[model samples]
Target: MRYWLLILPKLPANAMAIFPFILLKKASQQKDVVLINHEKIHLQQQLELLILPFYVLYLLNYFINLVIYKNHYKAYFNISFEREAYSFEGDLNYLTKRKLYHWAKFFVKSSGDRLG
Candidate 1:
């Protein structure tokens, strides 16, 4: 997928994928392959969902996870998109082999089966 990397010093996270743009907190992060791969996974998810709905579902998932986990960090990590990304970020070839809507597996997993 085609993507642009932009450095935004004030971004809350080290990096975030916003469709065609991958926003980074620092320019140096561009060299971080694992981080870039993680955001790339998000980019694929956004593309598959057609952007807006991806954000809506992402927020909804975060809120639901917030209620379940009662912590911002835990909620963020538990988000289906985040879970999918984190699970395979280290595998640089993941995107090439990923199936559409793979995040759904993470979303539908039983709470007891979730990763910590």
Candidate 2:
């Protein structure tokens, strides 16, 4: 499916440091490309998990990891979906007909089940 990205102007300072972020104002070509790819990865994940549940699972996993890890960066990095996205986002060709469940392998396992 085709997705369009919208850029917003002036994201919160905290968000700015990590994500290039989508702004309402015009964005530079490079920023637009990166943000689009990143958000597209999120969209693909959302679709795979049936939309609503993906977000619910995301929040729950994040909090659980935060409490267990006691480190925000580690918590975020440990997220299964984010792990996959970060691992492959730089490969501009990742989104083209990528296989489902390819990312699930990157999820960090806690015991038998994977985290996030």
Candidate 3:
């Protein structure tokens, strides 16, 4: 992952994946494996989508959810990619067992809660 640690971003998230890169809100969080694992999940998804399409789809989903929930935080939390990443971020070896396009399953179920 192409890491870029800085201050705050436009979004409310502490870290965000931009395909090959991960933009972190704080440089100190670099050693936080759980957070890195979370972003890594996003990297896998971005890779599967070949980058550009991933961002397009992500924005589409976020906008759709934003309309549905009428809440930015709720919309972001419900995004399929975020849902999938948040689900397995805690499992450091999740990348090994994860199936290709695993985020697809999230569209069928409500992936609970938000994680940093």
Using alpha carbons, what is the TM-score of model 1?
0.97
Candidate 1: residue pairs that collide? none
Clashes of each: 0, 7, 0
Give the lDDT of residue 49 in candidate 3.
91
Every model's TM-score: 0.97, 0.71, 0.83
Candidate 2 — worst ten consecutive residues by lDDT sum? 13-22
Tens digit of per-residue lDDT, candidate 1, span 1-116: 89999999999888999989999999999999999999999999999999999999999999998889888998899999999999999999999899999999999998887655
The TM-score measured for candidate 2 stands at: 0.71
For candidate 2, the lDDT comes to 0.62
Range of the 10 consecutive residues with the lowest summed lDDT in candidate 1: 107-116
Residue 93 miss distance in model 2 (angstroms) = 1.4
**Highest lDDT against the true fold, candidate:** 1
Instruction: Write the number of the candidate with greater TM-score, choosing between 1 and 3.
Output: 1
lDDT (Cα atoms) of all candidates against the true structure: 0.94, 0.62, 0.82
What lDDT tens digits, residue by residue, belong to model 3 across residues 54-108? 9899999999888878888888888899889888999999998999999988866
Q: Which candidate would rank higher by lDDT, 1 or 3?
A: 1
lDDT of 3 at 54: 90
